[model samples]
Target: MPAAVAELSPDAPAVLLAPLLAQFAAVARLEHVTRAAVELGMPQPTLSRAVARLEQELGVALLAREGRTVRLTRAGRIFLAAVERGLSELERGAEAARAEADPTGGRVAFGFLHTMGSEAVPMLLRGFRADHPGVRFQLVQDYTDSMLQRLREGELDLCLVSPRPDGPELTARRLGEQRLRLVVPVDHRLAGRQRVRLREVAEDAFVTLEPGYGLRRITDALCAEAGFTPRISFEGEESETLRGLVAAGLGVAVLPPATVARPDVAELQLSSPGARREIALTWVTGRPLTPPAEAFRAYVLSVRGQLPLHS
Candidate 1:
């Protein structure tokens, strides 16, 4: 161990040096023994002994006494600058931690897919804020893979994701189920039908999410189960946009019940091998959540049955 670490009292860990370093800063700023002692609210004799101990612990001469005053040694100037920055950063970190832990006004960094932001997330947050009006949220709208990456990197406190979390590091709770419907342009042959099998639309061109999105994976899986790969005619980031493509007669799409509202398009329930996607609330295992986020997660799990779904 270095001399400074070795000199720490056996019972007092090195964390104690942070405050002692602040004392050295107080004395160095004043440069007068009596004045620094007064500013520190300590007796001159006690402050003097503390400085001597500091120098001994570091194996360096930090101060030069000239009769009644003191001046910093060359090494002391460099050390003082570093100490001030360190102490200032520690203070900021403490303040941030306290703010994040506050029961009523803490912050939560929340993430979810674009599919949820329009109705689901807004409704969730509105209810959450009714109970905690002062809590702040940082919302991140992303696909599953991107959201999962941000969650692991500590950028998000929790995520509402789909196709249930798979990694060993993830902890997931199934929130509820959403039934997907086949959407087609009003003039298409399948539009008037209230229900159809997935295989019935096999030859139709499809509009889907980009491959990286979770919904796209679900779409591919449903297609595979239906015995054919879709010939994707259009791919976009938003479900509403895909619905628009269907409305324009560009292609048919499989979409969640909530996002398929357009006069020009019709939503039909699947008959055989019913199509649906499972929604889940996911977080990192063993990672702690900010107080506000934990509250939101608990609130969501408690009220999941009330989540909007097709009747």
Candidate 2:
């Protein structure tokens, strides 16, 4: 253990010293010296003295007395902001160090688009837990654009996306492609057709995904290529809700086979210029993969063939 400095002086910034800044940050964050000390697993008096020393060195009162609570002074608020920033930088540095040391068993944050999460996420999680149980997995469901942005900002360790953007900074591997099918109620007239064409159903009332979703983009582009614009009767975010709408005879929709394979609907392949969605796993180039993330990626690819509708 390193020797503790007795005091911070005018020449030295308290934020530059870890122990002093940590003590101050804890007290500032918790606003109670006893609670902060308990959380930090240090003696309350020792933590309180450290905070007092930091306040003396900074030449400002950092805490204000309330009836039964301690609050940050205005000066303390400003100093705490700087301390938070410093702590964030330190956290990243520590993450980088952990990445260097283990290259696995560290925290991994991942994001997946809504459609993929329907089935793929469960498979990935199961396999990941089986293989690397120690690693923590933080998974979030987001749109493609948002997920990609999170990956770029280092907020996510990996993302599963579709129609991957062409770029040098991103690395991607094709998981598989899924054929699009028109989902309709079993009692609907279109359900009896051996196969459907986009043009035939071009004008049908439809419950489709919102504009920016990968499925919606594919559906719109395919309809345009087929020489007609789809008449969208309703727009929704979840594939399950869209399927439910179709089952209720509200409207028809084009979706990946897996989505329509649910019990309430019948899926039909489109004959002309068949629509397909390409799924891929993406991550930042040159960044190390944490154990859970790597396991999840491998599991997705491994189970791709077994998925009900994946091609």
Candidate 3:
């Protein structure tokens, strides 16, 4: 360790030297203790003592007197260079922090399920931006569990999730529920039906989102309620991919209503009572959001029953 770090008292962390560093830098820049003191709005004697204290803390001689003026010694020049860079970085950090707090122009770290990316999320974002165009969003598309984990880790400010996650750690608002459909290849026998019972497909091979996804869990539960375990033939991370697999007749899938029409598959309504997944806006229960995040949350809730659930 350098002499300065070695000499510091346990309670006097290097952070405590911040003000003294500023004082020292001003003095070093002016090369005249009295004049630097005047520019710094402090008495010359107080400035002199602060500079001395800084030197003592650093265990180095930083200045030399010439007549009534002062000059930085070689050590002072080197230390000043480092201090100036550190101060500049700290200033930049402060500016970024302030910018994040700006209500109209700040950034919001928003997360949502991949299922919503096709339409619902984009629609919400477009409507929110219509009124607050300057606000920026950092969007994360993820599974419900992963998104909630990021929310807890401070990586996400808000999320639109399904199955309405619950716990002491989360705050969730029910936005509205969207109907889940049973999608089948167009040539399949049941594809001609406007609606079908969940149990009707009990023997059909299933294509689904992979395990750990909220929709997957819902699919499994609905299948169990329908009195059979789905024999999943293919699993994927995205709902669109599953839809495509269904189109290829790989297997049928349970999915949210499609935003765009796909002539290759037919979407049928479920006769099951709970074939719907609830959508919610979620965040860490006790965590305070930045201004932009809070604004976006309020805007989302304001639209409550108005989310574009279908294309």
Candidate 4:
């Protein structure tokens, strides 16, 4: 909280504008006054006072205190929803202003999952940079959930993610689907098959991604649907490690076609209904897309035809 926010009263006219609304939204998001204060780089007390003043002006208690934790009241929940819409609109306005000032030269931050980091990302960036050289790109690599959260908080302009939750605040466009293949050691009996059924591989030892990773969940679901539980051999995060384990004859693994792009591993198509994962580009709905983000999205769609899909 700062001295200025602390001094604000319910009757102040400035409380009705965008800045106060942004502060209220941040406080609502963090819940803790201190954490919200830290995010805003203001004194906690000042942030608390600003929220207090906003609540006063609205004639509603925005938050309910339970011990040290704060939860939103009904009015607060409603207010927060409105604040999200308002803030999104404000962001769009700012973006529009920036575009008016300079249509092409602006900074944009993008985040993507590790799975898409190698070829897809590079291709998209290269095509975008070729078209809009003046637009600066800031790339971030992170897991799916963290990337989505950052996008919601306005820290990222765009993100590439798998199918997940959707709401009025966010929009998604399909990039394309990637086939999930079975990777086995070269000397393994299954390696000679053109395509192996899931049931055939059900009893085989498996190395897979750790829980919370997108591919892990997909593999688990596919195995379950095939009426067999995978024989767990090793759990890890990186797909490269999983592939290496398979190549070393430790166990078999399920991965996207792109995962086996290297020549070291053998990729076999899975039968009994092969599995595929959808990839998409997502951003906050109604938020104005920066030139860089728009260009990247366009390039991804343009190149999507080249992506492999299950027959």
- Give the candidate number with the greatest lDDT: 3
TM-score of each: 0.69, 0.69, 0.69, 0.67
Steric clash pairs (candidate 2)? none
Error of 1 at 41 (Å): 26
Model 2 alpha-carbon miss at residue 180, Å: 0.5
Instruction: Evaluate all candidate structures by whole-model CA lDDT and list the values in order.
Output: 0.84, 0.79, 0.88, 0.78
lDDT of 2 by residue, 233-258 (tens): 89998888888999998889988766
Per-structure clash totals for the candidates: 0, 0, 0, 5
- Candidate 1, superposed: residue stretches over 4 Å from native: 1-96, 272-274
Q: Which stretches of candidate 4 lie over 4 Å from their true place?
A: 1-96, 164-168, 258-264, 306-311
- For candidate 3, the TM-score is 0.69
**Deviation in angstroms for 62 in model 2?**
17
Poorest lDDT segment (10 consecutive residues) of candidate 3:
1-10
**lDDT string, candidate 3, 114-230, tens digits:** 877877788889999999999899999999889998888677889989889878899999888888999999999999999999899989999998878899999999999989999
